[model samples]
Target: MAKAFASQGDLAEKKVSFTEVGRDLWAFTAEGDPNTGVIIGDDSVMVVDAQATPRLAGKVIENIRTVTDKPIKHVVLSHYHAVRVLGASAYGASEIVMSEKARSMVAERGQEDWDSEFGRFPRLFQGHESIPGLTWPTLTFNDRLTLYLGKRRVDLMFLGRAHTAGDIVAHVPDENVMFTGDIVEYHSACYCGDGHFTDWPATLEAIRCFDLAAIAPGRGDALVGEKLVNEALDNTADFVRSTYRPVARVAQGGGSLKEAWDACRTVCDPKFSNYAIYEHCLPFNVARAYDESLGIDTPRIWTAERDLQMWEALQG
Candidate 1:
């Protein structure tokens, strides 16, 4: 059975609006769904985080057509996830960019992650057949890279690991706006299956340091102004704390995965139960917490088979 939070009723995917944050920076966001951002320059355009597949990305491109006609010269992958990067080929982007760490992750466990995520959420991958293959970045940097879009400055920074080891954020310095892939989510579950729990809090702090006039979060509506920005950061922080602490506590007591899952339901369900994908994320979150509680620093790779095993082990 497809697992979903009690709070998330029948959520059907739909078209989103393209909100302009700055002169040429805009964000396309669906209702509590993964977002795709566009950065238009004097000469070319850059796409941030492609949707699940080429068919789904066509919707994003259609939205882009309403804005500018510039060819998409660059496609930036925030991390190596099938949902985030698999649709790059659809854009016909001349250059695909990523952090070196992200590329390494693609080589290590990219296929496994693709299977796991596809198995978990089929709705996100609307046009499943449109997936060309795994997306590989043509250009990669270590920590940071500054790309000059004509006169516009778009900085891609790998501040720290939260969502994944290769997670990076797109910061348009001129606009004081940052597109946080999954590092910061507004009213959405923090999918921490590949996350760095110990380092995630610190990563949020780094994101907070930016002079953010507006923020395009991984899911939900975009946040504008400092007040909303602060709210996003706070909510994200609270969700992470609520997810990790209780599971860690339960695991430390020699609790089984089911015990930890139940504990999470009691604590996190009340607080973040309304967030997007909460039900789908809880079991994986608890499993990671259990591992972390035992002094495991890195999260275990989530294969599709492992996902089912964990779900069966905890759900029953």
Candidate 2:
């Protein structure tokens, strides 16, 4: 490989921020790292997107403790990414939730994703040894499922495929706040290696239709108020579209993967170079865009070996 993954060199710990995005709802963000959402109902708490390891999850739990003593009874996984679901056990929630498609993906490529992510971003999986295994959901719903944390209705809906085939969003009806797992992002780059580029914009529009007041996104800081929420949504859509267009144009021209990479950079760099994880996500995003442009509907599973091979090929 010409160079290690961008995440491999990111060893410095990020400053953690636990901000209240809505009444009784909190967002645990670590600079640009993966974020966790907390929804406190009358009797219990529901968490969204568990961290990558049990140790990292402990931080979210610690923050949750500061505000509410209610037990975390439900842990909702937005998708099957190892970075988001592997830390589920740490929550000790009796009901671990995921969309039905997400659970199926776990059955198909969970281990490969675990190995691939661990190899690419060692810093995120600091306590890998503590992860019991591939995290599986104890509960799942196909389109939508409603859960009440003692009268606080929480709706989990599969809006559409964006970040992954099974991406879902948690909406708190009372507050009109949504915990959008990777379906929406703030300033951070979207990790689209397993994404659906063609379907992504529509998914964003679906979320937009909700006109959410606040959003605890998959990554980046919590977006509060309608203005901020809209800004994030628009920016995310722009990011997704910006990334795909150039790469698709290159691939449609029968260009090499390296050529597609360069093409994507030419367009995305000037606009998104300062975004968090921009460098880390660019290659994978370009590769997926290239594949999708060629009419590949399903994203090929990324394994550790494939990550290295793709990196080397792009470097060439």
Candidate 3:
């Protein structure tokens, strides 16, 4: 059976919907589940982010088959997250692309993240044993890489650090569309556990510079119009601010992590009550916010033990 989760208890289960945003641009979204964007070029194809596992991504590839028969040439990792990049090998893409910073993050904490995420979201990692190992990018760049899928131009650029140091957005100029992987999510909880909260808003602003008519966000539904795209970015920016402010204030006041978490809950839970993953993201979000508020530059690795300890601290 296909498992599902409810968002707002109004949007139907398995919130997966595909909207053709432009010529050969399709957004595969599942009710605020991690979205996979597809760009079909004349000669080949490029997938924005692989799903959580080969089984999950194979389903996406099956969808691509419905659109075109050309081989999938590239699978891009927007950042090093188990849910995003683990299914990369399934695409059989000759070139798996990522930012150099993201590659480093994979080298440093990918394994831990894999374990951590598997624990947090067992449903996403349904076929866990099938994951060969940490998915490594064959091609990495500092800022950007442009590919010509026949005559179509797909520019992958690392505008700034947001979700992770190596976050990148895939821009399709002719389509006036951008695939923002977790950099911007509409009506969903922003996972700041491994994020750069201070840099996230600026990154969102940088994304606004593009005259994009549509966007395929990492989660939530595909933003099909300029109005919806702006709303996604603005809502994401507001969520980031709401996440950081209360935690920072409490931390700066010399309050305990628990106190900071309480302050954050009081503010966020009320407004973002309907967002997906609110319960799952809050503890990690507050922990990262507290760390940033205390001048911690890089996010700490989250092991199973650390996750439990943090949960207990917050629950108590």
Candidate 4:
């Protein structure tokens, strides 16, 4: 029998943790679930990556209130994904920020993506009705947007295309801390549904310039200290390469999609099987890798229908 599509069957709630990674920086990580980075400036706060729904964002907000009552002045989106941006309303942030490219993507398919992801991860979208339509960025920049939290500075940079074309990282120069969206995952599976396999490695190389002391990735536990941070970076890079290389080879060899998925699984599952969302992300990741290997540079939009079709094809 075919399994449930995407994470719809993943009903188990994860335990949430609000850990202080730096002076005023906090990582709200829920086991292997999606994470939120909080940066408390002198006056206000900046939230990186809102949760999937208003209800979920409320939980993050409650955590934020525990440490500081500062208004969430800015909500920065690392990339344009329904699971990440739909919670903007909950923060009531003055400025919702993201890359211009991400804004374009939101304009292009934000509705479809919202529908697609909500269906895929029903657990994440518990209060689906509370979402007040699609989230729009009030402020968008091309490459970098520097936010001044009094004397401190948080530079939002678009290193290159990896997880998505508009993927960006928030770097705290003074602390040498980074809030890397999905560009760097720890134990969690890197969702490559919209990933750029070729450009990702180069993007990973750029992250080393920060000489990070700590990193809050999109998922998994926060990486503390230089060594662990680098290791997580390397692991994320490996996951990307391992998922792509085999699928690319199979596609170039004119292998079937099932064969390509099998090749990807043989490599990824051995190392990443126990990781969070490995099963849910595998089919979509493999499908995108297969397309990219066939010289398709642009990632096709993922709709609920396409998601199911691909899942059935690969799961069979």
Write the residue-wise lDDT of candidate 3 on 1-316 in tens digits. 3212111223334745778989899999997789999999989999999999999898898888888999999998899999999999899999999999999999999999988887777778788789899999999999888999999999999999898888999999998999999999987788999999999999999999996899999889889888999999999998999989999999999999988988998888888978988777888899999999899989999987788788667743
Q: Which residue pairs of candidate 1 clash? A: none
Worst 10 residues of 2 by lDDT: 1-10
Q: How accurate is candidate 3 locally (lDDT)?
A: 0.88
Candidate 2 segments whose C-alpha is farther than 4 A from its true place: 1-3
What are the RMSD figures for all models against the true structure? 2.1, 1.1, 3.6, 0.9
- Candidate 3 positional error at 71, Å: 0.6
Model 4: weakest 10-residue lDDT segment is 1-10
- Clashes within 3 Å, all models in order: 0, 0, 3, 0
* TM-scores of the models, in the order given: 0.95, 0.98, 0.95, 0.98
**In model 1, what lDDT does residue 180 have?**
92
lDDT tens digits, residues 1-316, model 1?
6544222343476667789877788888987777888999889999999988898789899989988998999999899988888888999988999999999999999899888878766777667887878889899999999997899899999999898888999999888999999989988898888887878888898988886899989988888999999899988888888888888888899888788888888988878877777777878888887788789887788887888788778753
Off by over 4 Å in 4: none
Candidate 2, residues 246-314: lDDT per residue as tens digits? 888889998888888988888889989898888888888988999999999999999999887887777
lDDT of 4 at 307: 87
Cα lDDT tens digits for candidate 4, 182-210 = 99998999999999999998999899777
Report the number of backbone clashes for model 2.
0
